[model samples]
Target: MAMTEPTIVPESSAVSVSVSGAVVGGLRDVPTTTLADLLGRARVMDVVVRPLWQPVPRVAGPAFTVRCPPGDNLMLHAAVHRAAPGAVIVVESGDLDFALAGGNVCAVAQRRGVAAIVADGLIRDLAEVREAGFPVFARGVIPIPGAKSAVTPLNRRVRCAGAEVDAGDVVVADEEGVVVVPAARAEETLTAARARLAQEAAQSLDDWEKAHRNRIDALLHAGGHEES
Candidate 1:
């Protein structure tokens, strides 16, 4: 028997909010560290899921969530073709023993206009993926390829690298790490991040140091550490 496509849940049931270009652009400008501060540590992905190659450009887009079953990569491969251009393909799988994807898969995803691939599992063909300049942030790499028999669906909630990601959530990632902005708060977070960025830009290093030092001194004083 042939495998069938995963059933997409009705849109009415799952409210997929569209992320705007302004949000994407603003997020790309801001740092993941800044977003981490804004979103808290829980919103940030684990440090283990880092860029395969250093100096990779930051990617920001609405997530196209994919859930690949353990030991199988059927859904992730299907996602490249289904995801819209500028979508960040986020895969949720804890399978470390097998690779979820390889070089060609990354290339195809890139050619199809995917912003990047953030996987909790491993991938093969590190050299080829790096040479192609495709962005892949995952646990690590493995030589053995994963079987593509486990058929799952597209656009679903998934947990990738300790962060729960829903479809259409704003995904901002770069060298630092990946951060997911909930769809409902995408614009709100962007405005706040931009404001914080602007404020920081206006202040000089000396100004920041003085304020930072003062804060530490006050906290220490409150803690009963008397000034000598």
Candidate 2:
């Protein structure tokens, strides 16, 4: 069956106020994968993703910000024109109630050079979205359509999973998971994350050897006691 576009409910939504240069250049440089590693390191609530039903093929990209109400996707349609190459649109739905993204948008996003779509709400049109093959991570996939009555301010700062994301934030997603790094924090995060990865890599062999030796010694010690 052909996938149909979901109806979006429009609402009177407002964009968060930002002072000069607050969200400007808010795009971060840390690899999206690096942030996922850091989250594992610190046990932080860093991995903020909706639900993963279908997998979007891995691709490189920057983040485009859009704030919308639950079930409203008006602003998202507008963002398609403003998106840059390798851009991923991060939709912050006010509450986790509506299906904010779906298949039709996925087709448009891919055509506009979007790398992925991350939404805090549900998504519809799973088969087409997967067929289009634009990476999408949402709360889950629901057959329900979205409401278009509420307003969704484009290129505004909005809270996503306790982290504030603005337009142009660097988004990286892969098999491990999704991570958002602020433009301001990218350099530092990347440097530190790289160092940590290198250190772990260098020590991995030694650590494994040590564990093997310990296991052998423990087993020998048990055999000796039994013989005695």
Candidate 3:
């Protein structure tokens, strides 16, 4: 018998199986506000990445984290192809001078069924991205493309927008901002978010006003400025 070489598999292939679709779906219905409240409003990303256009829908999915060198996007290109369907591609590009991705990248990601793209950097091709209707959340937009000399890591823990995000962390984003919920806390946080949503829905405007007044009264009393 002749000797044969074994196949070499990429590391990203291993990460696609780490998180289950059910786990990702659990967060699909949970609003970012509810998740933020349940997590003590702590894990929220800085309010830098906003929707390219107004009224973009909410996005929730497990993170497929990538850490590319500042102004480089080679790893992001690899990640887009390997990330599991419905995974949110989270990239930590350390600068905003150049774009890590553009409209064409968004098109491919959408075809691959990616839930969304969140970059702690910049992106371009806004006109096409808007037309494609793909959800992209990033710090800003730029016209220049970054260097691709560096080989970045994929499916690993990365700091994005000043927050620590592990590969399987659930990311929820809406009109307001993005929040990263650790994988270990997903179930508990989902339950709490559901309860909070229900509680908010059942509260009436009058009840909210009453509560607001009570809080203001308490504050005034504490400051010794309560009205006569």
TM accuracy, model 3: 0.89
lDDT tens digits, residue span 1-228, model 2: 996654433322342322222222222333445566664432211355643654544543556777777667666766666676577787777445557767777788888877777776677888887776667876677777666665544666766655666665555555555666555555555667778766666887779799888998899998784534
* 85-186 per-residue lDDT for model 3 (tens digits): 888999887686889998898899999999999989888998998888889988888999887667755777888887788887888888888999888888
RMSD of 2: 8.5
Tens digit per residue, CA lDDT, model 1, 128-223? 999989889999999998887776667878899999999989899999999999989988898899899999999999999999999999999899
RMSD, one per candidate, in order = 2.4, 8.5, 4.9
What's the candidate order when arranged by decreasing lDDT?
Answer: 1, 3, 2
Candidate 1, position 51, lDDT:
93
State candidate 2's TM-score. 0.68
lDDT for each of the candidates?
0.88, 0.62, 0.81
Error of 3 at 215 (Å): 2.3
Q: Give the least accurate 10-residue stretch of model 2, judged by summed lDDT.
A: 18-27
Q: At residue 32, what lDDT does model 2 achieve?
A: 46
True-structure lDDT of candidate 2: 0.62
The residue pairs that clash in candidate 1, if any, are none
Best by lDDT: 1
